[model samples]
Target: MNMASDHAHDRPHEPPSSGRRRFCQACIGGAAAITVGTVVYPIVAFLKLPVRLGESKPVQIPLDRLIPGQAYYADFHGQQVVVVMSESGPRVFNASCTHLGCNVVWDTAHSNFHCPCHGAVFSGEGQVVSGPVSAPLLEIPFEVKEGNLIIS
Candidate 1:
């Protein structure tokens, strides 16, 4: 019997197969894709920040001077809005419709404001009355100052 037959080095060694190489390439590609996606997400979000943050400013309105049935239209913080009195209390809302950016008008006959573009109507309480609009009217911050309505 030969002494070299008992040695572990007698067996041949082989390199990794093509399947292993492909698996490693796929793993590396997946990691690179994740890294690129993460880096691009923040850049896109930063660019969109300005549009999401609308012109927000606090405005003062003379709530006491306004009558119950009267609705006053004014520019607040670069946003056009309507101030009205409801059964509960003074309410301020963005005159723009929830469905579209259409300006809503006060309908004296129905005692509610109706969006002419899409027929979206809102009650005196800022509640949705009818039409395709499902969201309630937005009420702004307001205060009474010496017989005046102050909105912010």
Candidate 2:
């Protein structure tokens, strides 16, 4: 060992194919990844990002206009939602059928949700009362805020 210099003379040198080459390859890969991410991020922000159509906040629906014993339809965040005014206040249900993606309508005469495509039926509270639909209708998260119904 030289007193004026720092060196690893006592240790054996690692082969270039096993140690040096691998270190170099790892450094190159890391640099390439960083460069790609930096270049792609601006393009993603400018071109790949979707346009802003509306606010990200929940949609507000006027529950006061709903009439009891009737169902009201509303578009919430590009999805169809139905609210039935039962005797117990407001009951919200997803207007989509459980068996298929068919749109369901309220059967005023039968007091149930009817899917015309496959003949699926559900109660006002989103419970399936008939076959072909093993599960109930999907329920969305909602709240009544200041006489208005908010769906998220």
Against the unseen true structure, what C-alpha lDDT does each candidate score? 0.79, 0.84
Best by lDDT: 2
Error of 2 at 148 (Å): 0.8
On the 0 to 100 scale, the lDDT of residue 111 in model 2 is: 83
Q: How many angstroms is residue 94 displaced in model 2 relative to the true structure, after the best TM-score fit?
A: 1.5
lDDT of 1 by residue, 1-152 (tens): 46766664675643557687679989999999999999999999988847636456556666556677778888877778898866667788888888887888987677898999989889877789999999977777777767767676
For residues 67-99, what per-residue lDDT tens digits would candidate 2 score against the true structure? 887888877766788988888888778788989
Off by over 4 Å in 1: 1-58
The 10-residue segment with the lowest total lDDT in model 1 = 49-58
lDDT score for residue 65 of model 1 = 61
Q: Report residue 3 deviation for candidate 2 (angstroms).
A: 75
